[model samples]
Target: MSEGVSIFAVGDPAGAQLNAAIRRTLFVLGEERSEVWNGVLQAANALRWRRMTQPQPRQFQTQQPLIDDIVRQAKRLRNLVSDGALLDLIAEAAVAVGETDSPAGAVLLQSIEEVGTDGCVVVASKAAARAGLASWLDEIGATVLVPSELDTVASTAETSYVVAPPSFMPSSVVTAPMTPEVTFVMPAWFGNRSLPSSAFGGHAEGQIVIKSTVHTIGDTTEPETAVAEGKEVADVYFPQPVWGTRSSGEREPTSDEVEACKVLLAGGLGLWLDDGDRIRSLDPKQPEGARVGYEAVKGIVPGTYLVLRQGETERGAMYDRAVIALGARARGILATQARWKARLDERLQLIGSRRAMTELERLGVRSSGQVRAWADPRLICPQRDADFALLLDWIGEPSHPTYGNAITLRRAVYKASADLRKELESAVGRADLRALERDGILHLDLPREGFRGMIVARVLAKAPFTEIVSRHHVRVPFTDGSAQWLD
Candidate 1:
């Protein structure tokens, strides 16, 4: 490979000096260096910059951890700096710069040693310039220039190195050399302008760019070749499931359900058991004794039982809260209290008082007066005043006392609707209805009970019948079926 100079643009001055010292020590030892040097440089830059930017006493305190890291790295490299006096001087200078409160002058002095055999032109920052480190550097045969004197530097000359802050390093310093080698020592609070792509030879092939902040080596050649080869390998061997087949009882989801499930996943909603072990322990008799909970729809396994709230009374306090938690986006779908009352009155008128009372009695209504009130449009319906759970039991179609599958629940919803499929589509979108064809499925995204209950309500309203007969042990039917369930 052709010789190319490496540039280290560290965020902190002390960190830059430390990195230069480590790289120089590695070079002197004549051991494999670039990888180890680049790793340490990136880590040091990040830690130093973070420490400098942190609030108050934190920024002021000594970075003993960073010092420890540098010592540990040196030890890992067989303590190479101890082998030579020049390396020892560089190491001591690096430590002194890092531990000091004001490091600009110490860092600038340290940079003089990093100049190669051909020497370098140094551009001093305002702080380093005021510290009078330039005269010492110049005396050592290094051409030191202030930021204002950047234009005077002989850019056209084949210099070994050009060391400066990213802001002061001129275009001529980069493009003027046949194989330009530059090092930028960045400030703690430099403004938004980043080093140009040209500084790294437009990420050209064979160019190795080391950045301290991200700790990544941009090897332009290898990565592109790897990506191109990867595409060919993937084409030859399509991805397949690594695990065993799905359980016999699980049903594969239709394409429509998959699309709807995607939406539910995006919304972060899923079905959960209303009366799990934790919830049931809260209360045994009162329906409100326990709160409802939900799991992510994507996580529901084949055997899990999901809660289905079947109440049609839309104006309940709990129901209102649930609708509100669906977010303002659902305002168009959720009906108002007045609209609900009118719809209920019209239903009662169509059924007639006698038949309505008979249906209420069959649903287990004991009070004759309550039955009469609900049956008659003129009288206030008992449903208007009933508790949320009690209202569902009185008027809503009773769920299968044992089974909790989506197919069974959907059938119940279809039976309850006036126009069957038409009303079901109106209440729940057709796309969503198709999603309900599976067994024991529920989805929820929000943790709040209101949000959880809203998802349950939407599911109950839109559930559609499926041709699949089995419920228990039914595996989820997807193209990529696996035994492992997502938590």
Candidate 2:
């Protein structure tokens, strides 16, 4: 127990974009490969296993099965409103839309304004009757502004925008064409000129020039330009507020009472056999190296990513053993788990020939998770080595060293064969490998109906995961990129 609590302020494990970018950039930095590393892994073992595995009823996710769950429900609400169920629900809520002019549409407008609402913008076509729309807007207590027909909206436009880096007291993105009409709510300290000329700013044709900035946190703001030229657009965003006190390692711990807390870590908090079965508590001494591993594990979940929790030291993070393999797999402890998703995304120009991807999309699989389930797809789809590689190349590199390299189909085959042969050398090993393969692994084969299908990719690494496998009943169809540890 150090005298005082270890109060290293922690922040969210950056978004996939930044994470992917850093991992990809770092790897290429050493090798001088400007090209981005793709984020997919083709799991040979998983594919092979899927082929021979028996059908077992898989559990269905009960919470929400698809990303469109909300959208679908919202659409249902529209129908319900017409059918007359909406008036009944809203009648009891004590709220009115457009009042003398409230319509269900106006009600939806209000509902969408709440924090954390999956937001959408409503644009009405010209003949859509302004009176009814205004009636709807008034019912919803919304101010109706004439939208520019020629204006466009974009999520990312890096060509000429400059944003304050993520590291700042209050980070902000700058834009051009700042004006008073644009009611943008930004941090209080932010200045009109605080934005550099490079801030990604552009005009919506003849309507107005717009720029945007997101708050560090919570709902607070500094003065902002309400309008530019003539357009009446408001800035939309949630501000994540910052709070927490800082502490140092050297803070007073020499006192007697302070040292007593240290006793709790003596095998009292049960050890976490982190990735590679390295006792996380052992390396408390090297918070630096352990920190790298710490970050890898943390990416798995919010806090358990630690080698050991609280003040416990990491004991044997050096070994190749793992703790809670499948759970970690779900949390992303596998090499695929450690990747920086942003970098691979950059290379993924979304500009390739989509014929093949389109075909898969038509079938249903859209995400890597869904793709993993397509190894042994329905149509006995022939080899997709090259196509899959192209798709993988665009997803960006993950930080875990295990992902992205030569297709490794040939090498994986040889390695798989060798491993099989060696296992057969020890009959016990053969039986075990065969049994596990017969159990199951996942695959994906679609990008479109991904809402309905799967796409396939595989992660192949040589490791005696059976030990970890024995501990958990779940099978994680992925691998830790570290052959040294997993092996």
Candidate 3:
């Protein structure tokens, strides 16, 4: 909401901007010469943590095609990014767990079971804590993120498995077994899709969730015509058997279609959609009549199209990105507002309007944000105290959190590079220092004694902002008569 605060500003957080994060790892490795530097790194990582938690889309995602009756739809990979990275390993480094040799590591993969991909990355612990000659770091009992949080799609897939390192070999232990409820299989994406909830065998708990954008009030969602107006777009694949036929007849879900199959708006509510962008209702139900919570209205994707009348389109793509970035923060407001609106409407239907207005105003909660910020736990919730918490979780907020990076970059640099590379990195990055070097006021120097005792040796320094820009160094034994140091 501030100036220069657009999605583009999110910038690659994994870049040099994250130097502080790297330093924190270093500090944990027993490298500490400056406590002041540690404090700075702490704040920097906190900031990075925020942005890392924002609900951005996958950086690497392919299309989804599981329409064939033979190619039963399994869990998608795009939704795995939130699961964290997988551990990198080699066969030699493998260890045994619980008295078993060649211990197969486990992972906690999270996702919606069907949309996009999860970027929960697979990573090898760089830590030196090894069990033995067996690359101890790799062989230890650890939880690896299958797809890595770097991946956005893999985390949201319906069912995640605690797969072993090798793809072919079956592990002795798997989080999800071959049981019916353990494995989910959804219907086809397009072409006369029809199911009776009995079609998915026993795993009928799957529901296709969708966040549609609305234009007009009512329209048809027939796939036969180019602009088939649908008063509602029904993702009826969930809790029921339904088929969707395409206009051209060539069909394969891009990604969202497959995920939507596992979700159903509550009470058989229907959504109007043409290209996944919600239009309005078709079953002749008032806005107050529809369902509530994430089961009813999920969050929209990044590039959803609206008003596809062969010309203009909805510019909500930015809103989509912001919503994704703010994640549950934005969704919390929507869900709470929807639930509260339903409650208010119900109250109004029974009581006088004047009294309702007075009650809401008395609580200092005239808007959705106020409702979202309600820590009181005693608000007019539809259910119990955790109603607010549950609503936040549905929207991906009040649970997982992340923060902006650029605002914290400076602080991180100050922490990690108290006087090391960051200080020099900034020294080189700054215009004034660069000018000083050119004008002979400052010169990069490598002490004749090397890093053990080195200085920038100011020649004609004039900037009075020296409090933040000073230099110091220390050294420790490295090898025979040699040493390593950072200033």
Q: How far is candidate 2 from the true structure (C-alpha RMSD, Å)?
A: 26.9
Tens digits of per-residue lDDT for model 2, 402-445 = 23322222233334334322322333222222122211111222
User: How well does each candidate superpose onto the true structure, as a TM-score?
Assistant: 0.21, 0.16, 0.14
Query: Using lDDT as the measure, which candidate wins?
Result: 1
Identify the candidate with maximal TM-score: 1
Score candidate 3 by TM-score against the native: 0.14
Model 3 misses residue 208 by how many Å? 32
lDDT of 3: 0.23
What lDDT is reached at residue 318 by model 1?
33
Stretches of model 2 off by over 4 angstroms after superposition? 1-198, 202-242, 249-487
Candidates in order have lDDT scores of: 0.33, 0.23, 0.23
* Candidate 3 deviation (Cα RMSD): 30.4
* Residue 285 CA displacement from its true place in model 2, Å: 37
- Give lDDT tens digits, candidate 1, residues 1-487: 1333334323444444443444444345453434444333333443433222221122333345555565555456445434544334344544665564433333434554655423556554322231233334435666655444555656443333334334344444444433344554433323222443356576678764433231122121221112222222211011111222223234432211111211111111222121111110100111331223334433443323333332222123233444444466334333232233344345455664456556656655544223322322211223222321243343442333211222222233333321222322223332232122221133333333332332222221111221322221122122111111111
Each model's backbone clash number: 19, 91, 96
